[model samples]
Target: MLSRVANNLIWMNRYMERGYSVLNLLKVNYSAHQDSPDLFPWTPIINNYCGSDSGFSSENSIECINHMIFNLDNQNSIINLVTRSRENARSVQEHIPRELWLGINSYYLYLTKPELPNKLYQEDPVVFLDRLLNHQLLYYGKIDITQERGSAYYFMDIGKFLERVIQISDLASMKLKEIAKTSDALERSFLWKNFLLSIGAYQLYLKKYKSTFQEDFIIKLIFQEQLFPKSLYYCVNKLSRHINQLIQTNELVNNDLEFLLGKLQSTIQYTTIESINEQGLTNFIASIKNDITNISLSINNVYFSNQS
Candidate 1:
């Protein structure tokens, strides 16, 4: 594969994954703020996940939300992600099919228009989010149906799967900490539901467990479920499969990347929630984050960097 094509494929996946991440964060924060009257807390979420929240420096809920959601200065915002994705698509327009590029371009242009953000937030936030999600789905579907199943496809899969693994781990860590600290069962239950909804896993959870919300079961389902797409284990497993396939066909292998992924996957596969909680959830999550960071660097070395 050409270096330029590989770069485009990687970036295309990254941008879409970022847009989805921002959308999920916005939805979760919005629901939490709306449901809990006293808990008008929003800044912590922005600060933790998005570095741009620091610019606002205000504890006010509405102000922080507006700044995070609408301010173009926040490069990680939904609009900004969409814009960047379009720019990435533009850069590789010659490599991608014209129709596919046009679809992404049109979507971002619509999102970047001056009036869309205000109208979206004012007219109906949920509906606006739904529309954005639908567009994301459309782009993903287009890639699946239109793109060839080759090195480029594998790179795209790597980007999407890795992003999902990191996002789910972060969400689980954040929400589990909240649950552990909270004394009120009702609040815990609400937070757990919100976490599931943020990952688009609520309905799936209900279908799989057929039981009321409980912390242990929720943790198991989110972290360990092999069949669930958003689960960290599932994402890592899928990533490994793709990487192995790439190695086999291209005769290109990176031992460091494989070792990191294998170790992370094994840890998740064998460990129990009891051990995780007893040992300290924060430490376990931090370890996983380190592993992921290493795996990403290895991936760049093997497939993305010019030196590779």
Candidate 2:
């Protein structure tokens, strides 16, 4: 595939994945707020995931949520990601089909309307986020079904899976920290269940563990389960498979990426929840984030950069 096409595919997936990440975060926090009214702090919620809480510290929940959701300055905001995705789509307009570009462009324009912000923040925030997420998923489904499954598809898959892996890791880390500090059993269970729901894994988790809510079981499912798509191990395994395909096809030959992914897969597959707890789950999560960032950089060097 041409380098420009590959870059466009990679960024297209990245921007859409980012949109989903932010939407998931917003949905989770909103649910938590409903459950624990007094404990819900919107600012920390924004900061914990996207690091955009600093600018809107003094604002009320409505204002803060609006700013984070609609403001262009918040780079990770839904509006921003939509805009970025459209920009990426524009760059590769000739490479992608016209229908796909039109769909993406329509969504981008929908988000930027003058009245949309008020409707999203004041009338119903959850619905707004859900609509945004659904639009993104629709675009992805179209891409998967319509686009040719070639090198471009591989790069797009890499971006989606990698972004998901990193986002899930950060969420796992944040939930672990919250669980460790909280002393209330009720709150703990709510938070734990909320974590699962955040990743859309609660039902799967219940089925796997027979509705058991043990910390160890949750950790194991989130980290080790290969069937769960959001699990660290599953994401890494998917990434490794894509990387291998790239290598076999001669589109990419980055042994360093293979090694890094292999290390991550091995660690997640072999490490125990007990060991993670003993070593500190936060620290372990931090390490995983660093490893993922490093692997991403390696990919950029080997595949995306001109020097490669």
Candidate 3:
């Protein structure tokens, strides 16, 4: 596969994953706000998703929803995510299945409807977000059914798990920040529940833990649990497997890339939740973020580099 095509595929799926994640975050936060307007604030979300550098801040839930969902000027908005993902798909139409292209194109069209903003504003916001989130799920289903197991598919998975790691880390960071602001157990519980709900892990959490939410157990669940699809360990482990497949097929061969991934996987896989707490959650998350950023840079230089 051409490096350009591989790059496009990686970014295409990254955008898709990011858009899906943002929708869930918006839905969860919106519902949380309804439950306790005083406890849930949009500032952290705005700063996290809107890009702190964008200088966009809104306390009003409705206005934030408008900016996040519809404002094209906000580069991270759902509209832009769909637009960019579709554009990427359009560029690599021959490299992807027709159904996959249609799924993304349909997603773009849905977001383009001028009434979407109104639907969120006037109608139930959760329903509005769910419609879009379900579209994302359908999009993933199409990929699984249509895309063959090859370099193209591997690259898409790489993009997806990479984006998932970043999103989960960011969510953890935001929730931990909020938890730090208050010592009240009720507020802490709400923050943890909000975090899990935002990531679609609440049900699994309840089933697995089947008990009260403790900080250690919640941390273990999100960061280390192997069965949980969204856990950092699972995502990182999947990412390693996909990248290894690419390397085994000789589609990608970079010692630095392999070494970085190995180090990252071991860093997560070998550490205990007890050690993580001792090291401090903020610092641990920061290290993971830094490692992911480096690994991404390495992947770009190794496989997607113009020189390659």
Comparing 2 with 3 on TM-score, the higher-scoring candidate is 3
Writing each residue's lDDT as its tens digit, candidate 3 over 103-215 gives 89888888898777777778877788889999999999999999998889999999899899999999899999999999999898999999999998999999988987798
Give me the candidate number with maximum TM-score.
Answer: 3
Indicate the worst ten consecutive residues by lDDT in candidate 2.
Answer: 52-61
Query: Residue-pair clashes per candidate, as listed?
Result: 0, 0, 0
Q: By the TM-score metric, which is better: model 1 or model 3? A: 3
Model 2, C-alpha of 13: deviation from truth (Å): 0.9
Name the better of 1 and 2 by TM-score.
2
Full-model lDDT, candidate 3: 0.87
The number of the candidate with the highest lDDT is 3
Candidate 1 — worst ten consecutive residues by lDDT sum? Answer: 299-308
User: What lDDT does the true structure give each of the candidates?
Assistant: 0.74, 0.78, 0.87
What TM-score fits each model?
Answer: 0.89, 0.92, 0.96
Candidate 1 accuracy as TM-score: 0.89
Clashing pairs in 1: none
lDDT of 1 by residue, 1-308 (tens): 66566666666777788678767777666767876845436655676656643566765545555565567877667667677678767877766667778889878877767887676547556666667778888888788789777776787788788777777777777776677777887787787888898898899999988988887787788778989988888989988988888878763466676788889999888889888878887788788888987887776765565211
